[model samples]
Target: MESSSSSYLNLFVQETAFYNRIVLGTLLPDIAWNPLPHFFQTWLRNYIGGTLLYFLSASLWCLYIYQIKRSVYVPKDSIPSNKAMLTQIHFAVKGMPWYTLLPTVTEYVIENGFTKCYSTINDVGWIPYFVYSAIYLVLVEFGIYWMHRLLHDIKPLYKHLHAFHHMYNKQNTLSPFAGLAFHPVDGVLGATPHAMALFVVPMHFRTHIALFFVEAIWTTNIHDCIHGKIWPVMGAGYHSVHHTTYRHNYGHYTVWMDWMFGTLRHPIDDDESKKEF
Candidate 1:
């Protein structure tokens, strides 16, 4: 009787462990192979840090736009009426709803089968998270830069897809999401390459969170008037020129590539000023 009781207890423990593993593997596959530390890291960076930064930056920009519209001077002859412009800006920003549906869909696709192509590198461990992120960032930036330049090169696509963003030529906080109000094709083409990077590289949850925050911050800065005033050293005026002329400043994040390839367009600070390519 004693021997039988011990055997039953051992079987029960094994079954419980197996059940736990199955549950984790299904629900939280990112950390299934290496839980505990990886899970904590993901939670800390993604849920806590990333969420806080998104809200905080967005709130600050909203407030800044509100204040600027109330206080700034606008020439009646050259600029749209302040109230009219503000209404348009509000519409543009409100169009891009902040939701997790897209990311959730992407994550599900990755976990189920799409990630298998790159899953072989899963055993490469965690440190490559940062390396892969850095490489992906560069590749995405290059892709965006060239794609934007091409949009300008092709007039019909620019008129139909990119013109909505330039509707408000003057910079404002709302301009970042202005592009989001574009045709679905615009969104798909512009966003797919960045999203597809996950399948090309081994990424941890924390890397995804970091990329999200980096994109949000850079997009906001590129569209906002703040960069025009703050980052003057890094050719901050480039994006402003893009808005004003609709011809240049195609690079998304880093200016290094733009500078290297002679795509950098800086405005002339003088009357006889020629733009440095």
Candidate 2:
């Protein structure tokens, strides 16, 4: 058992080094970070990479949804003001470094064999890989559901920690930038499920990393207020309502949680007409 654990650590070290050398080194060669300890490299890479991904993805999506497709998605007089967007961007940018720390620490934990994170899909076979991935998602969804709900349900948690996120309480103030416009702790708590699932379920290392990055994209999508009309998905439409009502649609990724918890509010049921410009 000790030998097996050591092997996993070795693989983690090698993979992390290779990633830092190839990916991070190319982008941040001046930093001379490749030779640093694996933990530091992970921290640097996640911070840099996460910040870039957040800005780049949010910018492009904002362009498409707020500009290119504005007439198609954004309702007349419902477009967020420039000042509102800038505020969201400010909060998001300010929170990114602290938010990235969660994943960096999560990687460190997984590297030290503190979590059930496998190095590769082959270790668990194809069937189990998919099965485990589903399990991880479910665990994350459930955890985030309760975490988000409790953030509102508990007065102190909501007042001190989560209230910062509720500043954009309307469609006209919400935008792609509002996605990560959370207090550092608020944003981290919302995503804490991803890391927490590591200790509870077997997760593919690559899948875990990919999902974390994918979250950057997903959050932006759900904040755009453009309903994708995809059933079961907790899309922007539902999320827009959540902003206004403050008491509904606390689920992430899907509506199953809200539905089960009796907090689900369908976008169609919302009195706000989905009128496009």
For each candidate in the order shown, give its overall lDDT on alpha carbons.
0.51, 0.86
Write down the lDDT that model 1 would get: 0.51
Best by TM-score: 2
Q: Work out the TM-score per prediction.
A: 0.59, 0.94
The TM-score, computed over Cα atoms with residue i paired to residue i, of candidate 2 is 0.94
lDDT of 1 by residue, 16-104 (tens): 23433554455555554445543233333233333445456644764554545535522224333456445544543443332222343
TM-score of 1: 0.59
lDDT of 2 at 124: 88
Candidate 1 deviates by what RMSD? 10.9
Candidate 1: stretches off by over 4 Å: 1-59, 65-102, 116-123, 171-181, 228-236, 267-277
Q: Write the per-residue lDDT of candidate 2 for residues 1-277, one digit (tens) a residue.
A: 9997798777877776676676687787645885777788888888888888878987898888778888888876888899998999899889988998998899888888899999978888999999999999999999999999999999999999888878988888888888899989999999999999999889988889889999988998899888887878999988988888989999989988887877888888543322310
